[model samples]
Target: MAGIYIHIPFCKQACHYCDFHFSTSLKYKDELLHALVKEIKLQKSYLDNETVETIYFGGGTPSVLEADAISLLINTITELHTVSSDAEITLEANPDDLDDAKVKALRRTDVNRFSIGIQSFFDEDLLWMNRAHRSRHAEASVKRVQDAGFENITADLIYGYPLLTDTKWKQNLDKIFELSIPHISSYSMTVEPQTALAAFINKKKQQPMNDQQSAEQFTVLMDAMADHGFDHYEISNFCKPGHYSKHNSNYWQGVKYLGIGPSAHSYNSEARQWNIANNAKYIQSIESGKLPAETETLTEENRLNEYIMTSIRTMWGLDLDKLNSIAKASASPLLIAAGQYFDSGWIKQQDNVLYLTPTGKLYADNIAAGLFF
Candidate 1:
């Protein structure tokens, strides 16, 4: 199965810790929309004959688009590609934009899922992150989606911000459980380079993130999610049974997907391509009948490394057989090293499926890289 991702390149405001490609201005929005539709038609053959089972609208803030604009884009894509009858179409929305009217219009479209960015439910934490929505809007948007009869929903939450105490974090977790939300993608606060949060920390204007707190918060999240009967399907994603995100799950499972729009990346087994990150440049190039993207063919080493990194992070751990087949070498030494972690109760294996234990997840990245050929 294949997937399609459309990147919306505008946001109402910039979050302090966000590093995703986005522009704060909407001056070129109409041009960008036209470019996106044109790009979809131009790249219609990227996925070959595979049926697209998922279509995700991601990036800056997909919900910021007018309903008619979103409809036009979706319709344009449908005209160019073979969309599965039951495709999972998702839109990444900010809470502020998920108003009653917007949600109503969204329900009428092919968009079957909503991935809301409810970073935190606490007003204080919201302010610290410079998010544009309030705590009430976060809660209300979810209610509105449910009230509007959309069940396939996921909300993102952030923990371990300096302003979020254990008690407050628990409340956020409890709210999701209490609301019976089907899916959650939660993460610890991180200060990426070139982000406002990183600059604040460098200037000593804001307190730096505490690793210890992050670890504790992660543990708390694991316990709470498990207690609520959510599967730890991936490192950051948790969902009730049968509620995993089709688009993202396909991504982690190495399925080919075509990513359209500025700053988007598309992959089809052999190589990957990324569009220009600048909005204006993207529109101009697409208008000139060119896809304004760079391509990279994957080396065996690069592919193996990607497999190791992504596989180890999932519930279905790294596959030794797959590794041996790809590398054409015995992975005994790597298996032996992994066994040390297994002995320490950091990892476990059963039915040929290896996955990280709770303790190992804290060091997942380091562990996965070490097991690489």
Candidate 2:
């Protein structure tokens, strides 16, 4: 019913396109660990005693932590929460960090799923992204995890960058297929403001990201995934049947979850809160036994719009019945708003479930926004 997301706010190095809150230093790691524990204890009741079905370690790079550190956090959650016996525990890891020793060590922990950041299979592309791992590390780490007996795994790939030609993009997609990775989470490259990629584009040191290139690559990605028999469960994620990322699916389904660590966000049905992005400030506040987070109570409109945006992106589509439950008489107006999309052949309704046509998938965000309350 609920989940837990612990952000590991440290990375080995900064990637060119990354804007996530992380430091390249490990100096405050021990203190940060203690602070995370304190934050966990302090926020135990955030989920209202809901049984935790998933625990995800996402971040700057969760693999940077030793196995014992990972185990300690899991143990703490178990002590406070009635976690499901078969809960999905995922760790977002970097390829280079998943060497033989590291993978073996992680096997001792409760982490049953791996979300490896493989990004690209080409060394040139990897260098362009300033990723810490090499092409060799990218391929080998997946094998290492499989060899170590982990079945529920997913890998991330990035496309639409200037360095990734259509041919190279196909190769990257083919590589994941060849590896038999059951679940894949891919995204088009975006240059967020203030990141190195954005600065480079501003200075003309790097070409700006081309939206056309991204769109083409995304289309190609969807086709490839469908051809490979992977389910297009969500816009950015695909999986062999029944292999969806439980934690992320919970997120999209509006399940309540506690977010631990700096800059992590938490949500229950009523309100949402996020921890401060500064590690020092977060640690200071938590050490003082204060939760270093801001809270936002959800307005009916906010909740309605959020559901519309997330649910419409899935293959299951948005259910009109669920929409009306949030605010009575909401779906009738929504169907009226959707009349244009239906006329354009972009959406089709079946048994009150609004589904996006393949063409509509390209403009899903626009359609969702247009239908928002």
Candidate 3:
């Protein structure tokens, strides 16, 4: 199965911690959307006729567009590609954008899931993050979506920020339980270089993120999610049974997908490609009958290393047989390197699968890097 990811590169306002490509101005919204549709048509054959199982509208905030605009894009995709009837179409939205009218409009379209960006349920945290929506708006938006019969929902929450105490973190998870949100994606805040958060910390205007606090809160999250019967499907994602994110799961499982729009990335089994990050240049190139993207063919080592990086972060762990199939010579070296982690109880090898223990998950990146081909 295959998937499609459309990046709507516009937001109402920039969040302090964000580094994703986006424009605060909506002056070029129409032109950019048209370019997106054109891009979709241009790259229709990327998936090699595999049925599209998921269509994700991720971005600066897909909710920034009207439902009709979203519907038009879905219609265009369905017309050009063979999509599954039960495809998971998800739209990432900000809380303030999902009013009654907007939700009603979205219901008329093919979208069946909503990944709301309600980073925190507290006004103080929201303000600190420079989010445009208030805490109340988040609650109201979830209620509105549920009232409108959209139950396939997930909300994002941030933890380990200087402002987020353990008590506050529990409250955030409690709020999700109270609302009966079926899926949750949570992350410990990290300071990416050049982001406003990083700048603030650099200037001593904001307290830096504490790794100890993040690790503690992550353990708290795992416990809370377990109590709520949410499956810890991935390092950062928890979902109800049968409600895992198909799009992202496909990504981890190495299913091919086509990414449309600026800064979007696409991968087939053979190669990976990414569109130019500049909105103006992306649109200009598309208008001139060109795709402003760079492509790289995956080497055997690249494929093996990528598999280790992504698979080790998921519940599925890493498949040694799959690794051997990709790079026979590299597998022994990886296994030899992984012996240190295995001896330390950070990773467990069962049959042919190498899975991380809870302790290893905190250092997932480091462990993966150590085992890289």
lDDT per residue for candidate 1 within 1-373, as digits (tens), equals 8999999989999999999999999999989998999999899999997899999999999999988888898898788878899999999999999998999888788888999999989898999999999999999999999999999999999987789899999999999987779999999898899999999999999999999999999999999999989999899999999999989988888899999999999999889999999998899999999999999999887777788888889997888788766657566777887877887888888776678999999889898887877
| TM-score order of candidates, top first | 2, 3, 1
Backbone clashes counted, model 3: 0
lDDT value, residue 46 of candidate 3:
90
Model 2 C-alpha lDDT per residue in residues 62-136, reported as the tens digit of each score: 899999999999999999999999999999999999999999999999999999999999999989999999999
Q: Which lDDT tens digits does candidate 3 get at residues 281-372?
A: 99999999999999999998899989999999998889888977776754678889999999999999889899999888889899999999
Please state the error at residue 231 of candidate 1 in Å: 0.4
Pairs with steric clashes in candidate 1: none
TM-score of each: 0.97, 0.99, 0.98
Looking at model 2, which ten-residue stretch has the lowest summed lDDT? 323-332
Counting clashing residue pairs in each candidate, in order, gives: 0, 0, 0
| Displacement of the residue 138 alpha carbon in candidate 1, Å | 0.8
User: Least lDDT summed over 10 consecutive residues: which range in candidate 3?
Assistant: 323-332
